[model samples]
Target: MQRKFACFGGSFDPPHFGHLRIIESVLNAKEIDKLFLVPNFLNPFKSHFYFSPKLRLEWLRILCKESLKVWADKIEILDYEVRQNAPIPTYQTLQFIQQTYSLTPKDKMYLLVGADNVESLHKWQNFDWLQNNVEFVIIPRKGFRIPQNFQTLPFCAMDISSTQIRNKLACSDFVELSRLIPQPILELILKEINCKKIDKK
Candidate 1:
């Protein structure tokens, strides 16, 4: 039997509630049996990160452990890109997963992408191979166009963002921060919130 898996990669600078909701949505998806959370050492799309890659990875693990306890066995925290200690493309990550798990040609995995990245899909590294091998699951965002080829799940998409949380942390806005961040790692992030400086771009 082919095991269905999904990959949701992001910078996850602080692993907020928004990230958790996405994970829950994808895991609840009937088509996905397992989900992998890939935290970027540095998001290739931008320059500089607000927190260290190690810290981000740790926060992700904690988020999964506390909030996602129900999915302990169903979720995995991938450290491949973080281990690389640099910005790594999605194609490489997927390739590694494919080889590591011995997924045959017939065994296809799902790749979660934001709707904003839909139009520029071909600009991605090895777009053809990605489109052919794995199913592209679109996380709907208003004002962005989703292609017919991409799969859409009944995800409870939240409007929260890491950028907003970063601002809140900078200003020590605990009231709002408490609501935006995941309960498990909220204090963990506040403890060393100044680990690194970022552009907030």
Candidate 2:
């Protein structure tokens, strides 16, 4: 039997507990053999000029360790998008994975995204190609309504976001930080916070 895998792509600027919850929820709902957490190297549409790619990757590694108890190997961080040096389109990423992994039509491959992203899917580059190749498993985001076409999936009404986590960190709200991210990820963020403080002086 072909193995089923879910592909979740994002900046994961600071992979938080909300991300873990989504992964866990997906695992529970499907017979997925693996979950590919593909973080973008340099998102064309999204502004990642703040955090370095290495730091983002490290934070994600720590979060995965704390929540999943598994290392980076299990979570494929395909940095192809970032390394492309040009605009990294979503359809290209999906196509590369299909070719690299020999993923046939029988093997299930899902593109895990949030409701906000699903709502904006039409604006994405080569969206028509993306729709034909990948199955989108969308999770809910705050203040975004799921479009009528996407109401069929096993959607979770998660209201958390990475932006909220970043805001809490900026305010030195360590207590809220712990609630938002995994213990290991929180430690990584704390270290970055302290480093930034020391640099200012």
Best by lDDT: 1
* RMSD after Cα superposition, model 1: 3.2
Q: Estimate each model's TM-score.
A: 0.92, 0.87
lDDT of 1 at 111: 91
Model 2 scores a TM of: 0.87
Return the lDDT, model 1, position 56: 93
lDDT of 1 by residue, 84-183 (tens): 9889989999999988988887776989898877877788888888878888889976577677866886675677878888888879899999899876
Instruction: Give the clashing residue pairs of candidate 1, or none.
Output: none
For residues 1-201, write the lDDT of model 2, one tens digit per residue.
Answer: 877877888878778777787776777787777778777776667755456677877777666766676433446656666676555777888888888889888888888877777657888988888788777777877677776665324645656677888888889888878788777767867888789889999
Instruction: Give each model's whole-structure lDDT.
Output: 0.84, 0.74
Model 2: residues with Cα > 4 Å off, grouped in runs: 70-75, 85-87, 151-155
Residue pairs with backbone atoms closer than 3 Å in model 2 (clashes): none
